[model samples]
Target: MKIKSYFQFTNEQRRGVLSLLLLIVIIQLSYFYWSSSKSTSPSNSNKSWLAMQSVIDSLKISQSSSEGKIYPFNPNFITDYKGYQLGMSLTEINKLFEFRKQNKYVNSALEFQQVTGVSDSLLLAISPYFKFPDWVNQPKKAFSSFDKNTYENKKSIIRKDINEATQDDLIKIYGIGPALSERILKQKDVLGGFVTMEQMESIWGLSPEVIENLNKYFQVTTIPTVNKIDINNLSVKELAKFPYFNYTIAKEIVTYRSMNNGIHSIEDLTKIKGMPNEKIKIIALYLEF
Candidate 1:
């Protein structure tokens, strides 16, 4: 049996096939024309795409701003991690660490930059946060433990424990009166107890002559109880709480401690920048290692 050929189709059937092909072609052309000449995009899709881009840009800006956040802190205490956060390079950080290791101090913005060799822009950016101790802000009369005059008086001078002295007992001293005597007691109370003869010098409104007379008679025996700071755990604020050390000295002490493993002896404290050696002996009396 032979298969029938396409020429066997009737004209009606052929016209039907052509009509079907024409209809399909027309439908595809109309679909393409409408798709290519669209009226507008859906508002939601356009808005959503734009909104996603905006969110991504906002996150990028937030990340950049976060990098600029700088908390106020004492520059002297910057550890390697803290230095890194402040945008310091390893060499700059190491230079700062080296300067501190010498038992030295950075007292100004200029000095900080000099020690660290930080960029001028970075120094300016961070300079406002540089905090030195109050003493660095306003220096006091220079003191020295090696001063020969500190021990100039005769050995025969009478001395009494500052805490044991009564108002009348204090009055017997050449320059002390009832008011002054009370002031001394109050100071002693506030300080726990006098740990050094030099502490009398801190009494308010006392003339130098009067201070000398009082010093001739008064001395420190019993140290009032105090919570000594662990040099290893010291902060500038904590070290300043001691009656013997002021804010400036406290910062120096802590900075020195950080550079070194920790303060090991009174002698170590003397090495701190501008530490009064005479006071250090008295200060040492109250502090543990």
Candidate 2:
């Protein structure tokens, strides 16, 4: 009986010991799992930091390449370097805005130069940065042909017939001002059309040089026949038929011719009190004695 009891007590103690061992093994496994989970959490954090660092490095590289591409040929960048040397004051530089408005680049820098006398080297420095618009170099070719045609037509009219020519035709010729055109029309009304090129010089205020310049562009082919009248017998109305001889001048001419017993020669015209040698010379080409 004693032996059985001792064996029973030993069996019970062994079972208790096995239970404590099992508890200790479970505690160790839990500790290992917790420690491995803590270690893996730190490793995940480290990997995340590495990934973030890679992303930041990629962004830095991209920024560097972008800056490299835009460094050259930037107009603003070029202007910044050149504007300092241009010597343009704030007010003068402001004038560029006005010039930009009208698109007039030819006179853009002229006013600035007048004010500051900016050096030529400085002007050259800024010249490249200031882009003259493409249209300035490529002016409208639309008027080119029209201008050429007008120039040719003007030359043709000056050398052509004058009696049949209209006012439009007369204006095309050189040396014909508005006053001269009126004078020509008045002379045509009094003595018909021009019979000789020399008659143009007889117009009021016309100089000899003007007549000489115009002679190259004109010619005379026809002369109108004037009825031979005895100057002494001529009435004021008949004497007024002469070109530039107004009613007052006609009365004077008729009175003088009557007093002088009818003018017969070109020298007789000079004998009249009001008729000067210069005046007779101008009218001689149109008159028939």
Candidate 3:
């Protein structure tokens, strides 16, 4: 009986120890699941804190580069963007200026690439602010009746010869700005005179628009003959040949004709603002309109 009781006590003790071990394992598993669930909950603030840190890092980089200004980024960062390149060259930059003058704002870097098959680095440098003005994208405004007729009247009076165009003849070309007109005159002197319309392109400041506009007015004819006795077309050298006409009077007459177009009739001679009537009549007999 004593041996059987001892064996039963040993069996009970083993069962009790096994039950306690199972309970401890169950509690450990439950605690682990609860901790995992808390970590994965959407209400966890750590994720937001990590995102904020990333944004702060990006802002720090931007501020350091820009000296704290928030202006748009410079185009030099094209290298950082995948598949983009600093593909333009110095020669391409010169071509962009030429293209811009001809097309105004119609051309962009993409269009330039299409036209020249090369990119422009200077244009890329300025591309961040590149934009066409509203007027360029919109249809052109029509000229008023007075403006149209005034241009027509002026066109009828102006005469041009590509071989012998004076500064005044160049000014008459539409779209030839004052600066460009002066450039043409300077080029004419430098080249010893223009032999062809293409020569105008050699001028450093001559825009393509000026060349196009002036081309319409160009004539490649023999130089016109000027009679020494005709005051209308006579140069200072020819006028000085007259016995009584001094260099001053010759220059004055040429200046007057330039301002008012050539004196239309002998009676118009007296209309020169400063010429005395007696002197006009003397010159009138020798002058032809």
Candidate 4:
């Protein structure tokens, strides 16, 4: 009888099992419905994200455009940030830096392009905004017209001796004026008179062209009488008074003279370390052993 009972199902137990199965089915159905309704579709989600991205992109474009507004500026003075805003490359900016380092400048838009090697289209874009100094835009003064006959007569004029040239004569050279003429005469007076044409180089303001003209017009036909200084016997202080010998060279000479019993010639002076070998010939003109 107990074995038979083990196989038998009570009505209450069967009903309980059926009720539990029904409850599980209801819960599963509710979960499926809730999941389908609560979650969004893939298409809708992508659409929403794309719309937000477009708004973000538009805002960025507007901000960049507003901030990048250009004003009138000198192209010569572009800083790194300013250059970036002007659409300049790193290479181009560095080229400008190298030009400025040499103490040179770009005076015109075309010159700026040549120095920086910017593109023509870019130059055209930026050139309208470039504001250079007033002097740069002004037309250069034209040379005055000379009468052909007068010009021919002037060219035929004979060159004169420079040694005897007066200040009025000196000013007739292309570059010389009142001030330069005065300086030349003063230097000549200091030297007791010009000896060799090479001595004209010491004149402070005479350009090579002016010197050439002076040489063309003048010759040291008569060597000036210079009172030669006794280099061996003069005190260091007195020796320093010579135009070519500064106090430092004078002291060095005195020190070497003391060590070697006295400097005898140009060779001895050359061996004194600080004596200028190249200028020895000129220095010898005013010095005596």
Who wins the TM-score comparison?
Answer: 4
TM-scores vs. true structure, each candidate? 0.39, 0.36, 0.28, 0.46
Candidate 2 residues lying further than 4 Å off, grouped into runs, are: 1-158, 174-182, 204-213, 226-230, 237-241, 246-252, 279-289
| Order of candidate numbers by TM-score, starting with the best | 4, 1, 2, 3
User: How well is each residue in 1-289 modelled by candidate 2, as lDDT tens digits?
Assistant: 9888766657789999899999999999999999999887767778899779989999999998886232222121223233344455555555444544563334233443543355677656554444432222333335445587788876775465456556665554455666566666677656666777767766654445456656666566565543334455667897676655667777777777767776777788776656646666546555656
lDDT of 3 by residue, 1-289 (tens): 9888766657789999899999999999999999999888746488788769989999999888876232333221222221123345555545555655564433344664654445466456545553432222334347666787788876785446776777677766655556667776765554345444655655554556557767767854553332227778889887766643667777887888899887787676666544556545434544567
* Candidate 4 TM-score, true structure as reference: 0.46
Off by over 4 Å in 4: 1-159
Displacement of the residue 46 alpha carbon in candidate 3, Å: 59
Clash count of each predicted structure: 0, 0, 0, 1
Count clashing residue pairs in model 4: 1
Q: Give the per-residue lDDT digits (tens) of candidate 4, residues 85-201.
A: 889999999999999898666879999999999999999989999986543564555666788987887678676656688999887766677778888888777666777778777
> Which numbered prediction scores highest in lDDT against the true structure?
4
Off by over 4 Å in 3: 1-125, 128-157, 162-172, 201-209, 218-289
Error of 2 at 65 (Å): 82
lDDT of 1 by residue, 1-289 (tens): 1456645779999899999999999999999888876645446777799879989999999999897687777787799999988889999999988998986667788998999999999898888887764335543446566655656655556688877888888777655566778888887775667776777766654556667777778777666674455665767887777666789988888788878978898878778987878666666766779
In model 1, which runs have C-alpha deviations exceeding 4 angstroms?
A: 1-160, 171-174, 177-179, 202-204, 215-217, 220-227
Error of 3 at 36 (Å): 73
C-alpha lDDT of residue 56 in model 4: 96
For model 2 the TM-score comes to 0.36
Better of 3 and 4 by TM-score: 4
